[model samples]
Target: MLIPPRVPNRREDGLLHFDLLPPLSLYVHIPWCVKKCPYCDFYSHAISSAVPEERYLTALEQDLEASLPLIKGRQVSTVFIGGGTPSLLSGDAINKLLVILRNKLLLTPDVEITLEANPGTFDDDKIKAYREAGVNRLSIGIQSFNQKHLDILGRIHDVNQAKRAVEIAMTHFDNVNLDLMYALPHQTKDDLDADLTMAISYDPAHLSLYQLTIEQNTYFAFNPPDLPDEDTVADMQDMIEMMTATAGYEHYEVSAYAKPGRACRHNINYWLFGDYLGIGSGAHSKITVDGKVIRQTRFEQPPTYMLEAGKGRAVDEEFTLSHEDLGFEFMLNALRLTKGFYPEMFEERTALPLDSIRPYLKQAEKRGLLYRDPTIIRPTEKGMLFLNDLQQIFLPDE
Candidate 1:
C-alpha cells in the first residue's frame, strides 16, 4: 500500500507521457568470466588471460550513449551489473562505468546498484573497493557449499572460496544476496540441507534458490548428469521454503526470498513490467511510448557489439507490441508474482480495457487456477504449481 509517487514530468509542453509512468531501471552486462559452467546458457565467454578492461569499458560507454535517445530524462532507480563475472572487473573499471552512467543518465542518489559476483574472482580488497565505487548490493554465486557438488557443476570456486566470498561481502555490503542451486546431479537431500545450512549461517539478507535444469547447448545436455527425479526436486523445494520461512525470509517471487525490507528493488521492477534500458552485449529492453510498448535487444556477441556501438547497428531487433500481445506480456510477468497485480494496472499498461481479459480471468477462476478479488488478480496454489497452464489462458485465441 506504500507505492512511491509516480515519476515527475520534465517535458516543456506539460503533456502527460507514459514513458514517465515510473522511473526506469538499467541493466549492464559484463560478458567475461574465469570459465564457463557446464549448465550455464547465458551470453558469456571465458577469459583465457587478462581482461581487455579499458577497451570493454569504452565500448560499454559508447553503447550507453547510443541508447540515450530511447530513455532520455528518465531517472534510473536501480542498476544491476550482471554477467559471466562482474567481479572480475577491477574497482577502477566499475567506477569508470558508474561515472559514465552518472554523466549520461539521470541516476537517483539512492539508486540500488547491484553487482553479480563470482566467488573465485573476488577478494576482500576488491569487495571493499566495489562498495566504495557505489555498488550497494552484492549477489554472490555460491552454487553449493559441498566441494564435490561444486566440482560436478564445473564451478571454478570451491566451498571454502564461496564461504570467504560471503564473509568478505558481508564486511563491505549491508545488502548481500547468495545464489544457490538445488536438484543437482547426484545430489542428496542431505547435501541440499547442508548447503542451505551453510548459506543460512552466513545470514544473507537475500537468497535466490534456483533448481538446476540441463539447458540445451550446454555440456550437460550432451552428456547429462544423473540428476534427481521430479519427486526429489519437489521435496527439495519444500525443504527450502520451510527452512527459509523459519529464518524469517519472505518468498516474494518463485526463486527469490528476502528478509523484511530486503527484497531486491531492481528485480521487482523487472517482474512488475516496469520500463528499463539494457546496455552491453546481449542485453534486452522494454520501453513504452505514447501508451505503446516496444521490445528491443542489442547485439549479442562482444566483438560485434563493440563494432556496432555508436553505429546504430548495436540494436539487433525491435518490435512494437500488439494490443493482445501486450496484454499477454503484462500478465506473463505480473502473474509470476505470488500476489499478482492490481486490476487497474492491466488497462494502464496494456491500453486494453479490463473487459478484454475478463474471459480468461473467468476461465482461470472457474478452474481454481486464479484468485480474483475486485481489486487484484493472483494465482492460486494450484496455479503456481502449474503456472504454464495458467499463463496459457491469457494467450490470444487464434
Candidate 2:
C-alpha cells in the first residue's frame, strides 16, 4: 500500500525545463552495525539484539511502492544496497528482497546491483547466495589490513579477515571494490605504503581510497587523534594515484579508481547527477517530475521509518529544489568527477541552462580554480586539488 507523493504548490516557472529524462537507479540503505565505528558519520545504529530483517524488508517494499509514482516510465539500471552493513542480513533475505524489487520495478536485464559487505559479517555460503540473488558487484569495507590500524579505527576485522573476505567476494563476483582509507593517527609513510601494496596485490576491479577526515559528532571528533599532517596526506594521495595507475587502474572520481569499463554505474549516475530512488531508513532520493527536480528523505530512525511506511507515506521531509539551489547541488555532485561533466548535462539534469551559473563559472576559471572549454567542461588539475573552492563558486550568495 502506498500513497501519491505530496508536490508543492510551486510551479516550474523561473526554472529550466527538460525535453529528455536522465538515467535512473535505486539505492537501499540498511542501517544497523555490529558496533559503531568512531570515524563513521553515516546513520548506523549499533545493535544489542538481532536485526529485524524480515520486518525491515517488508517496510522497504512498502517504501519503494510509495515511490513508484516518481519513476513510472523509467527503467532502473543499477541498484546499490549500502549501509551500516548490508552483508549482515542473511543471504535468503537478500534473495527475497531482490525478488520483491524485480516484481515491483522495471529493472534492466543487465542491471548492475552492488552490495556493501563488512569483512567479518559474511561467509562463503552467504556471499555465493548473494551472487545467486543478482548481486553482480561487492564492495568490501577493508579500511586497512594492519591489526593495529584496524584497532585504531575501531574496525572489528583483522588483516586475515580482510584478505579472506576479498578472496571470497572475488571468487563469486567479477566486479569487486575494496574500500580502503589512509591518513591514520601516528600513520607513517611506511604504514601507508604497506597498506597500498597489500590492496594492489588483491587486484580488485575497483578501489575507493579515501583520507581519514574527523567529522563533527563522531568519537574521533570529540577526542581527535594525531592524524598525518596536510603535506603527508597529500603525498599519500599522490602516491596512491600513481601506484594505482601503474597497476592498470584508472583514477576516475576523486576517491574512486577502476579497471577498464569497470567503474561503479550507480555512483557514476550520481556523479553525473542522474535520478535515483532511495528506500529504507534515512535513505535520500532525488527525482525529476514534469521538469521540476524534487528531493525527499524517509525518517532517519528505523522505527519511525517502519511506522511511516506502513501508513503508505514514509517521507519525513520533501522539497522541490529551487533553480538557484539546483545549480549548486548539481555542481557539488558533478565536480567530484576527475573529468568535468559535459555542458549538456547541466541543462539535462538540472533542467537549468548553463548560462544560469556562468558568472560563477567565470570567477572559478579566472581564479585558476577550473579550466573552461567551449566544447567540454571539466576541472583543471589545480581545481581537483582545491575542489571545495571551485564548487563554492556555484553556491548562491545569500
TM-score of every candidate: 0.93, 0.96
| Tens-digit lDDT string for candidate 1 (41-85) | 999999898788887788888888877887766789999999989
For 101-188, candidate 2 gives per-residue lDDT tens digits of 9999999998999999999896999999999999999999999988889999999798899999989988999899999999998888
Predicted model with the maximum lDDT = 2
Question: Which TM-score value belongs to model 2?
Answer: 0.96
lDDT against the true structure, each candidate: 0.85, 0.89
Clashes of each: 0, 1
Off by over 4 Å in 2: 1-16
The positional error of residue 197 in candidate 2, measured at the CA in angstroms, is 1.0
